[model samples]
Target: MDLIDTHQHLILRDHLGYAWTDTLPALQGDFTPADYARLSHGKGVIGTVFMETGVDDADYQAEARLIAGLVGKGGMLGQIASCRPELDAGFDDWLAECKILSVAGFRRLLHVVPDEMSQPEGFRRNIRKIGAAGYTYDMVFHARQLGLAEALARACPDQPLVLDHCGNPDVAGQGFDAWYRGMQAMAALPHVWLKFSGITVNCAPGTASVALLQPYADAMLALFGPERMIWGGDWPVVNLGVGLPDWIDMSRALLAGLSADEQALIGHQNARKVYRLPA
Candidate 1:
């Protein structure tokens, strides 16, 4: 089946600054669309949505514009640009800019910031505006911050919230029970959807196998159902673990028991619905 990768990250170190990549030697170099197309070739990947690479704050808009220029190439469908909902000033104008670029949605790396960063009323209010402007908000927080994520989702009932990386489960630490409970709570929120990506990174090095990831995958599939679960390659970051092809193979194995239509829903159909992609 053709796949629409909803959480691909592209880094252009020449044009933008990524202070976060300094410590991680694996992600230090540029990962451009051309590179992505080459790696994803013949992998059944037909489209992709660029997930912002957490560039230094000064380069956020530049990062968006850079991706905008490459959208039609490499099957890049659109982007989930970096945003700061905590600051209300110029947010609407920024949204307008994103609309012009045909951005699919927005994301803020909540995991790197303070737990209380999103607690302010203004943050929730701005998130509601993201939905009103016809954009989805991707929630990227650690497994421990699931409750905070759920609270944000509840506060903005009308906004569509995507929980990236299956709530960033702590697979390496074998933190399943707590992750499970947190996921169950997130699943209870109708507006929250889960992105089946990045679990491999959370696994112990060289130990990311379908066998190791099955339970977490099953919980996500059962809790969110096919309609609310979206697939993503997580690309270069995924390279930190089992890599793209292995992850894809593992994903297929996990969904082998499901009907073809059900598999397709998680693979591509739900992405279209959640990101408002063109038919």
Candidate 2:
């Protein structure tokens, strides 16, 4: 079966001011839908889900409008537009607008925030908004912040939470004890899911081997199993290491040991179910 990439991103960098936007010069330029199209042909990229770019906060609706317009015409596929769960005032109204546009979900930058941010009553309250609206939450946090993901999952109660990049394991040649333990804890929470994406590009060069990543993937598959897992390219951001095809190759190599059904779930079915994309 053809694969579906669940967590690609398309945004103008200057527009996002992503904390690490300039981490690599290769990603400085726009990675638009046209770019995705060029790389996806013959790659089994049957569909995709565009994650938030952390761009201009004021343009949430504008971004939603842009995403819906593009995907409506099949520029890419589905999208998870940006929303700051930390903000107050008119958030409900903003969320209502997004719902009208059919955005997939929401996200907040947890790694950059203080550790205490996750415990904050206000932040938790904001997170609950997604559950209230019946949306998923994309959590971008470090290994240390995995504890925060646990807390966030408990706080939301109903929202389906996804941890990006496998807790961004310190896979740069370091042991993955911390990330594994974290995934185990988070996976126990039935409402949350794990996103298999971005870590390779996010990690430092030559830090981890495919062998190391296997354990992390295994732990998640054992816990959440394939049904709760999803695929993501982390695109342009993935530009830091190998490009899309290489990431897909790495994904296949790592998943080679799994059953066909499990492989189907991780590569496409799980993403479709969680993100509510068209089949």
Cα deviation of 35 in candidate 2 (Å)? 1.1
152: Cα error in model 2, Å: 1.1
Per lDDT, the best of the predicted structures is: 1
lDDT of 2 by residue, 1-279 (tens): 457776878866544444456666776778888888788777777787778776655666577777776775543557787776666876788788887676878887678767877787887888888777877788888887788888888878787788888678776746477778888888888888888888786457654346657776777678788788888888877777677877787888888888889888888888778777775
TM-score, one value per model: 0.98, 0.91
Off by over 4 Å in 2: 13-19, 206-209
Return the top candidate by TM-score. 1
Residue 206 miss distance in model 1 (angstroms): 0.9
**Candidate 2 clashing pairs, residues 3+ apart or interchain:** 172-207, 173-207
